[model samples]
Target: MNVVEMLQEEKVVAVLRRLPSETFLDVVRALAEGGVRAIEVTMDAPDGAELIRRTREVLGDRVLLGAGTVFTREQMQAAKEAGATFFVSPHLDSDLMHAAREWGVPMVPGVLTPTEVAAALRLGAEAVKIFPGSLVGPGYLRDLRGPFKDLKAMVTGGVNEDNARAFLDAGAVAVGVGSSLFPRTDLEARDFASITKRAERLVRAVRG
Candidate 1:
């Protein structure tokens, strides 16, 4: 499905960062069982390329794989070859935005203010990701609604069950959950079921 369709349908993006290689497949499976399909595997991870490739091969179209923390053209290219059709970064770089457009890859560049949001839109970004969103809180998103009511926003950072719904209610089209969804304890214990339960709870909180 397209990014817009995926966002509207799933309303959540589980950000997997530097996840253990051994349990990567199981992690994805757990997330899927809870009805979360959009997954962003950080490119900066130790074995990102292999993970991306394997995720694509194993999940097929069952999940929408994205390359996150992607900043350079080389990184984007590597991710593309590894089966990531979409890209996400921590900052809004005009060049990176243009590069993604040229590559025909949907890139969600991060933004912290209205000016950056407008710049991203002009650069042809399909959507803008609000980084460190937890620090800014739901009010920040609510404030952006006036000038960017028509745009789609993804809140990444500091999102948990406590505030996932608040972010979505405020204006975020989708919320990206990292450590909150995949706790280190559960991962270490190979508690895939717990991961699935967490994902289910988060999904329900936002989309219910």
Candidate 2:
């Protein structure tokens, strides 16, 4: 399937941000074990490119790997070289959009206002991401759909198992879940089982 189709099918993208490198793979494995097929490792993580490369090598085709929080051409290029099939950024940028096109990688750039959404589409973003999804809630997506019915939007930030399905029902193609999926205390305690259970719960909530 195409990137967008795969994302819609997965219904969830487990986003890992600045996680402890030592347990990175463990966390990924746990998520995948819980049936999450799409995963994103944010660029802010230490040695992010290498981590992407390693995850691709280790996970093979079992998971769809993506690079998140991308804002520059350099970051996009590095992520592409490191085997990221898709790129996601918190904001729209022309340079990064063009790079993703040239490299033949799908990019999902964040957009808030209707004007920003139009700009992102014109810039060739494969999909638009609504960051700080908490600010507007699922109702906002429903409102956007009234005008941009064909728009593929991924909701991120402040997402949790409780509201994941609501976002999808409101027109979100998928949701990017971060800290809610990997609680800090659980990570510190190496409670991978808990992470797995959370992942499973989210998958059920969104995909049901």
Superposed on all Cα atoms, the candidates' RMSDs to the truth, in angstroms, are 1.0, 0.8
Give the TM-score (vs. native) of candidate 2: 0.98
Name the top lDDT candidate: 2
Pairs clashing within candidate 2: none
Q: Residue 88's C-alpha lDDT in candidate 1?
A: 93
Residue-level lDDT tens digits of model 1 in 92-115: 998888888888889999999999
Kindly report which residue stretches of model 2 are placed more than 4 angstroms away from their true locations once superposed.
Answer: none
lDDT of 2 by residue, 34-117 (tens): 999899989986588988998999898899899999877888788889989999999988888888888889989999999999
User: Scored by CA lDDT, what does every candidate get?
Assistant: 0.90, 0.91
Worst 10 residues of 1 by lDDT: 1-10
Stretches of candidate 1 off by over 4 Å are none
